[model samples]
Target: MEYCSLIQLKTTMMNNFLTLFIAAFVFISCAKEKDPIIGNPGLAAQGEWSIPLNRILDGGPGKDGIPALDEPIFVSPQEATYLDDDELVIGHSSAQESKAYSHLVMNWHEIANDWFGQEPVAVIYCPLTGTATGWHRKLNNQVTTFGVSGLLYNANVIPYDRNTDSNWSQLTLECVNGELIGTRPEMVNLLETSWSTWKTFFPDTEVLSTETGFDRSYGVYPYGSYRTSEGLIFQVKDSDDRLHPKERVHSIISGDYVKAYRFSNFPETAAGIILDNVEGQNVVVIGSQTQNFIVSFFEKQINDEVLTFSLPSDDLYTNGNFTSSVILTDQFGNNWNAFGYAVTGPNEGDQLTPTMGIMGYWFPWTSFYTTVDIYGEQ
Candidate 1:
C-alpha cells in the first residue's frame, strides 16, 4: 500500500526523457492506433504540479472503473433498513425534496451524479480524506458527469469529468490536468450528519437504496483499518503535525485563507455557538457533541442590518413549544434549525445562507492550506 518509491521512479523517468520516449514510441508502434489512451496526454504538460507526477498512483481502479451512480434509487427513511442509526450520511435538499446518500453506498462508488430539481450535481465522498462535498456539474453551459479517476493526490481522491477527461483534485476543488486545467467548479452546500439526526429532522427524506446496478456489498466498508489507522497508503508532498493526521475538523476557506475548527475543541455538552469573523464576513458554527454533528452558516442580513446570533435560553421559550434541537436564536428572537431554516419566530420562512465549507481530516485540509488558522490557538 506504500507508494513513496513512486516519487523516486518519477524523478528517474523525468531525468531520462530520451530513453522513456524511445520506449514509449516502440510500444506505441507495436500497439494498434485505434487503441485509446487511458488518460489525457495533454494533462502531463498542464497545471502546476502540487506534487511530483510519479506520486499520483493508481488506486487499484481504472477510469470510471469505480462506477458513479448516475441513476440512483432511493427509499424512505423508515424503509432504509440498510443503514445503522449512527452511520454517516450526506443530506441535500432542493425544491422541498430531501435525499440522503449513505456512507455505506458512497464508500464503494465514491461519487453519485443526480438532479436536485433541475440542477445537476455530483455528491462526492473521499473516504481517505474523510471529506464529503457537493459539486454543481454544469460547466460553461454544458452539464458534465464525474467519475473516479483512480488517482490520488495528497492521499485524497482525484475525480475526472467525462466531458473533458480532466483530472480534478477533490481537496483543491480545481482541475489539475487536461484541457480545463486551473478551472474550478461551483460548490453547493451539503449537510453532513448522522443517519439518526437526518432522519429525525427530515422524516420524509429519501435514502439512497442499495439496489444500485453495481454488484457489491452495500452496507460494509471496503477499506479495512484505513479509517482508524494513522498511516497513509499513498505518498503526499507535505505533512503537518499540528494536529493528529486523521483528526476530523470543519474547515472554512475563502480565497487563500483557511480557518479550521476541531470537533474536540468545541464544547460537546453545552448548548452554545461559536461566532467568528472569517475573511471579514460573520460566520456561526453550531453543533451537539452528544449527537456528534456540526453545521455552519453565514450571518443573515435584512434591510442592510446584519444580525447577531445566540443559543436559545430556557427563559426565552417559557411560553413556546421549543426544544433543545433548536440551537440558534438570532438577536431578533428567530429560532433556527441546524440547516439554518427558521422553524419559528418572525423569520419563520426565511433560511440563513449556508457557508461553503467541508468536514475533513486535518492532514488533507492542512496539506492544501498549509497556513490554516486553527480556532482557540493564539
Candidate 2:
C-alpha cells in the first residue's frame, strides 16, 4: 500500500478542492454543541491500524464529533410530520417489529444504538458514502454501544466500540484498529427506500423520532451537494468509474467477492427479482426504482434446501394494491416479503436468510472490493 507521514496526509487532504470547501461546511454543520473537535489519536497510536495509518485523518468532530444516539426515542408514523412521502429512510423489519429511521436524522448523527423490541442494534451509516448497515451490538457476551471516532478513512466513517475503543470501518464491515482489530461485526438486514414505500410495507412501523438528546438541524442535510455531485470530500482508492460516483447500488458480498445491482438494471419500475450467485452462494436481489427500494436475500429453504423465487403475479400491480412487501413467491408455494419473511404456504412464518449486503454509493464499494462486478452491466 502507498504510505505517507500523518502530517503530509492531512496537508494533502487540505489541498484537495472539495476538502477545503467541505471542511468549512462540516465544522459548522456537523460539530456538536461543544468545541469543533477533540483530536482523539487513540486508534492511530502504536502502528496498530489495519489500513494505512496515514489515511486515518481527523474528521472535524474528533471523537464523538458527530454523536451517536443510544436507545433513541421513536414516534408513530402519524406523529412523524417531518417526513415526506419521497424522502429516503433506512428501514428494517423482523418478526417482532418494523422500524424506519429517517435520513434527515441520520445525516446529522451517523450511528444509532437502538432497540428493536428485545434485540439491540446499531444503525451504522455514512452520509458521505451513502451506506447504512445494521450491526448487532453484542460481541460475545458483552453488549457494546458504538460511537463515532470522528475519523475518516477513504472518506467513510470509522466507528469505535465504546467497550474497547476498537475502530471499525463501516464500509469494510470489519474492525480495523484497537483491541478487536480484524474482527467482523455481525450484521442484520437493512434497506434504504423512500418513506412512502416503507410505510406501505409496514404502516404500523415506528419512526425514529427527532427527540434525540443532541440539538442539531435534523431536517437539513449537513453536507451540501455531496450526494448529487460527483465530487468527494476525501480521496478514495477508486479505479473503476463505470458509473457515476454518486450513483447508488445494492450489493451482496460473500467472502471477497462482491456484485452490485443498480436501480436502472431492474427489468421494470415495479419490484422484480434477480437470482444469481456470488462467491458460490446463491442470492436473490429485489428492487424497484419507482417504489424506491433495494434489498437481497440468500436463496434457501428453512430445511437447508435450495430454492428459486419469482414474482407472484402481475395482477397485484394492475389492481393498484402492490405493497411490494410481498413481492416474490418461491417454488415451494411460499410467499416472501421484501425482508425475506415467508408469509404464506407451507413455510409460513419462516424467513429466508438475508445476504451480507447494504445499499451504498458506487465509489466506496469499488474502493474496498477492488474487483466488484456489476450485475447486468453491458
Candidate 3:
C-alpha cells in the first residue's frame, strides 16, 4: 500500500511539475496585495516605516543635521503640567516633524550579532520585556524582528502616525496603571540576547550596552535603511536560551505533515530533530513538484550545517506516479513519518487548477509552549 501511494504520488508529481511552477508564478505575481498600506494609507502606515532603536539614536546625521546619540532627557513633573495622563514624553527633536517613542526608544542598548540575518522580528515594542522594534520595509530587505511573543507582556508604547491617526498625535505610554510592572533590567537583558544574534544583518551597526544601572543598549551606525531613507527604527533582539536550544533543527520537504518531536521528552524542549549543540544545522524541504513548497525554520541557527537525507527519484516513482512513505528519526529512535506523491504530467481527467498554499507555522512562545497550526488542502 505504501509503495502504491509512492507510485501514484510520483506519477502525479512528474506530470504536474511544470504546471505547478507556472501556476505558482501567476498566483504570486497577480493575486496578492503585497503592500499593507494600500487600503489604510495612514501616518504609520505611510509615513512611519519600521526601524531599530539604535539606528534612530545614532543612525548618522538626520536631515536635521543631528548625529544620532543616546540622550535620555528627564523632565520635571512640575515644569510641564501633565495634559495627557498615563504617558511619558521624551524631549521633542526639532529636526523631524514627529516625535519617536521615547520610553520604547530608551528601552534597550543594542542587538547581538550572530548569523547574517536570522533574528525574529516585529513592529511593536513591549515595555515589560523591552523587546519591541521594527525595520523599514524599504530598508529591511523584506525582513522582520523575532521573539515578540516573549516581549508582548510589557507592551506599553503605542506609535501613531498620520496614516493610522493624526500626524501630530502625541506618542503615549499607556498601561493598565495598576497592573504588575516588571523590572527593566530583566527586560533589557532579554533584548540583548535577542538582538545580539542579529547584529550580522547590519554590518555597519555596533551594539553598545548600557553604562547606567538600566539594562538599555544601543546599536551605533550612520547609514541604515531607516534613518535617512525612511525616518525611524527599533532594534530587534535575540531569543531566550531556554526556549531556543543552542542547536538548530529543520524539516524535509516531502516531510510535510510529518511533525518533529524531541527524543528527550524534556518538558519544553521538543523540536523536529536535534543536532550537535556546538555546530548549527541546515535543513531544506523539496516538494514533489518543484516550487510547490518552501521550507524554513526559526528560533534555531541556519548556518553551514550538514543534512543527511536524499530523495531517490527512482525509489519515489512507479507507473507515471510517485508514491512513498518517508520516516525521519532523532538519534534516540523517536520518529516523524509521512506519505508523499508525485507525477510527470496531469492525469487525463485532472483539472489544472493552481493551488496557492502558504505553508508555515507560527509558534508564539512566551516563556511558555504554544502552537499555531495551519489547516489547508491544496
Tens digits of per-residue lDDT for model 2, 294-362: 788876855676787777756445443355478778778888887888877898998878888888888
Residues forming the 10-long window of minimal summed lDDT in candidate 3: 180-189
Give candidate 2's error at residue 120 in angstroms. 1.6
RMSD of model 2 against the true structure: 9.6
**Candidate 2: worst-modelled 10 consecutive residues by lDDT:** 31-40
Steric clashes per prediction: 0, 0, 74
Pairing residues by index, what is the TM-score of model 1? 0.82
Which ranking of candidates, highest lDDT first? 2, 1, 3
Report the number of the highest-TM-score candidate.
Answer: 2
RMSD of 3: 27.4
Error of 2 at 368 (Å): 0.9
Q: Regarding lDDT, does 2 or 3 come out ahead?
A: 2
* Candidate achieving the largest lDDT: 2
RMSD of each: 10.5, 9.6, 27.4
Worst 10 residues of 1 by lDDT: 316-325
lDDT of each: 0.78, 0.82, 0.24
Candidate 3 — number of clashing residue pairs? 74
